[model samples]
Target: MRKLIFMFFTVVLAVGVISAQDDLSGLTGKKAIKKANRAFNTFKLNQTNGGDDLKEARRVIDYVVKQDDTKEDPKTWVLMGDIYNGFSSFNQAQKVLNPDWENIEPNGGMVAFQAYKKALELEAGNKNALDGLSQIIGSISTAGLDAYEAGDYMGAFNSFRSILDIHDLLKENGAASPLDAEEEYDNQLYITGLAAMSAGQNATAKPFIQKLYDKQYDKPAVYDAMYKLTIDDDVDAAEDVLTKGREKYPDDLGLLFSEINHYLKLEKIEILEEKLKFAIEKEPENPSLYSTLGNVYDKLYQTNYKEGKTEEADKYFNLSKKYYEDAIKIKPDYTDAIYSVGALYYNKAAIVTEEMNALASDYSKEGTEKYNMKKAEVESLFSEALPYFKKVEKLDPNDRNTLIALKEIFARNNDFDTSNEFKMRLEKVESGETIEKSYFQ
Candidate 1:
């Protein structure tokens, strides 16, 4: 989330200097270091083209780095860093144009980072090592973000981990680190954890997320992750974490939805409106929340109508219609919301039809007038419900409910021909022919 809160940068290809090539057929110790440096400088200057300097650089430095005397020298380690770093840049640049191009050193970036760290350990004030370290850090950060954006979670994690390793070493040596601040450190931890989690490496993810939990990271995402992680092993503990998070962040949209879903499972519909309204306030553009709020009021409408509380039922009916229309305004193609609005009108018409039927036996003057008025209201409700169900039929042609609704509305309007057309389609669907995939073909 939020680009991992990393400062995205274009890694600068900002350093390459040259020196004369030298033969080192029998070179050892300081002579070997001189040969390696010469090879490194020339290779750095010419690696992108077809050049033999990279072979020369690898040949001398690979053997020289293992010698005890050379290994002790900070200059030797600095040269090692430069050679590998240049190799990484060359291979990566080449691969951009030719994806199948061979990577000369696939591990070059990590090797460069390790070599630079070694140089600093040997002599903390080594300027070449420091300069090299600065450049490679940006390179690694850019690579991490690139990998993340490309959906390579594990690759992103490795690059980010290398940056974290460097930051730790810098801290241990009392040097400045870009992620030294507590907030930045926590952000890095969260992102690193997120990458691991996305990669399906929960074992690797636990430690990074655990660090944030221990430090009481303020963001609600941590609590959400922790809740999910703990749920399988300890349900009680998972509930506790969710409870605490909801208490701390009552208004956070994610946490609010978590609570909303919990009550939904428990069948606690009465308490959902306030929570859903709060969620709407947090994410006004989200149609699902408005749809859910509409569903809550729709249930209330059914309950009050069944109890014959017409005024209360009408109030909830209006509320349900309002939120459903709000959701449709936001997402025109939301099938469930569209269908719910149509059902609301249809059910209300059915109730009015029942009332009109009750007056069928009363042929008195006032009773006939009331029945006529109720019949007109019933037809009006059916007319209001017609377009929505027709839209549903177009959006999902195989929908049985939508087809049935269309047939009835058409018949009610004296359009028997159109009603019978849908009736035949409905019969074919119920007989399982139109339900088959071959039907569409």
Candidate 2:
């Protein structure tokens, strides 16, 4: 009799469990959405507690979103957004509590954004959807700034781009946008383009960058970036944009340098001197500008001297020497300027020696005296060149050119020991061995 009662009770208990499972499996779309929202609210309110409520919400919402009964309802999509939004906040809370915990959904904010946008599509004036999106913007902005600071540029670009997309949507629907102010919107466009360009997303970056150009954004970097983007396909167009940028921001060093480089690339050295002068005035402390300007004048002197314009050549040679000296004063260790100055005197010495040798044919006493005077002048110039080449060697021991210059100068000065020493050093360096010590000392 006891066995019969126990079996009957077990059968009743099993039937009761089956009924409860049937009720759970046959939940309506509306019931499932309500359950999701309830679970989402519980997770949202106690996010710091860390429980399975958020997981339950996600499961219910995922199932309901595909159901015909609730898929077309704006409330359903809004609930969908709320569920993911809860996930985002809950993840944040979990991270703060446990620093080493991995994020459950790193892109939960973006997921919420799409859900809210879909809600708006279902019902254009959905207040919940609009408010959710506005809130999502702040979350995305934080993510973007963090990514940008970390040098994750593509991630930064995506986060910023989504905010702009939301901004546009808000404006199209005649709703208030945080970026409604013209200046704020323009700045967002500029930054989005900057991030995209840095990520090497040229095709993705073009629209934002080009829009800034069209709108005449008042930043020099915009034009600098625009020039780079346009230069490959249309050089004339690139120059046109850069010229406009320079005109807009005349004192900007970056634009100034871009113009200087452009002229240098075209070999338009005639205009480059003026541009370089402008750059020097803007940045007088820069040694490279002085060196470049010195080179420009040096070239000019050589051209005029070759053409027999002695007065013009003298004028340019003085200017060249002045700028080279200015460069040395700014950076005493500037090897290029030191070498250039040495080369200047060495070249003049060569010219004078050529003139002196020409008098070998004239053997009269007066002619011999004249030859001696020219030879003395040549030696004086070579003496002037000697100290600068020595400094170059001390500064750059491996410089083959300076070694050759030192060898020639010492040989001309009749210092065979020093000249032969440099000759040996040069040969060692050429054979890929370092000279242990200088023989000149």
Candidate 3:
């Protein structure tokens, strides 16, 4: 009985101590702040290098945050942020000490960010919270870049998104944001949009891209991405976006090209012609533009020829030659333009050959003359294309296309020996063998 009574008294004493500790109504404004600061100092001093010190710091700060008089106080929130920051620091140090210890509790950075954000909400111009927020932003930015470089795009997207969210929240709450508003949004939006698109998260990318477009952000890539995303489902809207982008960024070649591509897709040939002409006007010396225009006319020539409109087909073929000549004049050694010109002559000759093959055998005197004239016309066209193909070979000695063209052109011109040589070279190129000497040279 005496032992039981002593145990009861011990339990009663323990309950009284617990009740007093749990009761924080008496600990208000100044007292609560003082205790929080003291706990913070103890944690910072790292006297014990133990979890107990950090736990105690968090307990005191949380108590201050929960107290009636200090619940709305900016100072209380600042203390909460500091406690969490200390938690993060302690966990980092502990991880260094014990490399295997991975389960660091409470996500200290997130907690600190939230606490700082709350402090700013309560006092928009709070310098302490702003400084802490800046540190958090810097850290997050670093994390995002690391994740991006590692091809962890989703991780990078989340990191960048958090930064934007914080900035937006600060602005929405009438806080004095330290971030350069327009520049920050522009950079973050572009990266986040691109990351989201790369991750195959179209739903996530749309808003970011739309925001950039709406703001007329001076980013050509945004317009390009926007058009690519919407071109299939809503072509008109995509073209409208392209038009607006071009209007705003008149010199942006990307937007100009996107506009050209849109009209090409719609089969609006007249519009395509106009757009290409305008682009050429803007950059008359750009070889690529002339090359593209040449290709466009090549396609049109084929279209007209297929409809049996030989006269119209000849017109487009001549136009194609003009552009190809223009491109070659600007960039004399342009391999692609040179190849296109050669292909044009070769194909036109093939058409004439088809016509000659369609005629009857010319054994009679008059028939022989007609057949020979038609054959000469075919050979002349192939001859015109031959030197251009040879030039292409010199410009790009290892080009597979050039090798194939040389073999065919020689065979057509009845130079069987030279044709066989080019065929051997083409076989070697296809087999990935190194060619020591230039075939044409």
Cα RMSDs, all models: 11.2, 7.5, 10.6
Worst 10 residues of 1 by lDDT: 9-18
* Local accuracy by lDDT, each model: 0.81, 0.85, 0.79
- Write model 3 residue lDDT over 304-392, tens digit each, in one string: 99899989999999999999999999999999999999999888888878778766565888777777788899889888998898998
Compose the digit string of candidate 2's lDDT tens values, residues 362-436: 999999998999999999999989888888887777788889988998998899998998898899899999865
Q: Candidate 2 lDDT (Cα, whole model)?
A: 0.85
TM-score of 3: 0.66
Q: List TM-scores for all candidates, in order.
A: 0.64, 0.71, 0.66
Model 2 residue 360 CA deviation in Å: 11
Candidate 1: C-alpha lDDT = 0.81
lDDT of 1 by residue, 5-90 (tens): 43232122222222223444556768787776776677666665554677677777877888877888888888888888877777
Clashes of 2: 0
| Count of backbone clashes, every candidate in sequence | 0, 0, 0
The TM-score of candidate 1 is: 0.64
